[model samples]
Target: MVRGACTLTAERADTDRVLDALPGLWQGFSATLIRDCRLRFRRRSELANPLIFFALVVTLFPLGLAPDSTLLSGIAPGLLWVAALLAVLLSLDGLFRDDFDDGTLEQLLLAPQPAGVLVLAKIVAHWLTTGLPLALASPLLGIMLSLPGHSMGILMSTLLLGSATLSLVGAIGAALTVGLRRGGVLLSLLILPLYTPVLIFGAGTVRLAVEGAPLAPWLALMGAMLALSLLAAPWAAAAALKLSLDG
Candidate 1:
């Protein structure tokens, strides 16, 4: 009788321990996420400067490509949107690179919070820095691209949703290649193929607007892509970070 009682007691204690730890774990994860976000915004000066470079790149397109209003109008949406995507990619490395450089990433791996949460926190920061700015700037660039005023809402909406996915998906490549000396090219090579679907859906949504097609299908695809990437990319990035750290 005593033996059975003790056995039940041990199991209950174990269950209690697990239940107690859940809140602490959640708190730690939340703190990590909030910290990354706070740090990112605090360095807005450094981060916001990337928009300037993106704007300059967009301006150069008209000069380099045909200056014909009709041609520019036809291709402007695609070119400007693609340029924004490329600009976000250009800045993805800065997401994890600084933490890795300063050995903070290693410490994060050692934290009580799961590595996946840490990865997610960083991705959130990247989205705030790169994706949010691009979304806000898309309207101005949309005008530059000769996108009709009627399509501004669609262009901005698509860019906002699509770029969030871009930041998340691109972070996996950035995290995977972060410690490598020559990772820039490799990161692009690894991520661009993955980014293609997002680019297609994003541009497709805007193009649909230009042609007066239904917005539902493209928006659905973009939402699905964003949801999937948000759900899965963190796990992949976390696994990659573990591998990199282990090596």
Candidate 2:
């Protein structure tokens, strides 16, 4: 009876500890998210780089191809997706680099809250600044690419879902390379293969929409990917950040 009572007491204590930590975890996450967003905003050039790249890629594609609306429309899904993917990649190299250089990253690792929570906050901030804008701006680019008006909604929706996964997966690569002097090239190499699945599902979903096919299955698959990334990516990125710091 004494032993059983002790086990129950310990379980209660553990539960209490988790409950107490919840508030701190939320505070840390919100602070980190707000701070990162503000910093990115202050750096206007950096903030605009991905959007500019996204637009430039879509704009140039038409000039290089024949002035054929049908052909452009046919290829629009893939073209828009590729532009967004590259835009995300372009922004990723600097995800953690500024913090690492300024020593804030080390402080973040040493903070009382779980590193994964803090890292997830940064990832959220990244998506807000980079991926969210890309999704919002995609319809204009879609029109330029001669994508059918009917598919514009799907294009934006797919990008909204897919880009979050990209940011999560890219954070792992960013954390791993945060300490390198020249990690951009290596970052791309590390994450591009991981990016393939998102690219496929994102482009395919839009393509299916353009073709007047059912979108449920493709959207379901993309949601699964996003869910898995949400569950796994932050912890993976936290571990990678530790490895980078230790090395």
Q: Which stretches of candidate 2 lie over 4 Å from their true place?
A: 1-23
lDDT of 1 at 85: 84
Q: Write the per-residue lDDT of candidate 1 for residues 1-247, one digit (tens) a residue.
A: 9999999998988788576455466676677778887887788787776688779888998899777778877886788678888898889878788888889889988887777877887787678778888888888987877778899889889988999999889989988898788889999999999999888888878888988888998898899999999899998998888777776
On TM-score, the leading prediction is 2
Stretches > 4 Å off in candidate 1:
1-19, 22-26
- lDDT value for candidate 1? 0.84
lDDT assessment of candidate 2: 0.93
Tens-place lDDT per residue, model 2, 149-199, is 999999999999999999999999999998898899999999999999999
lDDT values for all models? 0.84, 0.93
Candidate 1: clashing residue pairs, number:
0
Best by lDDT: 2
Q: Which 10 residues in a row give candidate 2 its minimum summed lDDT?
A: 16-25
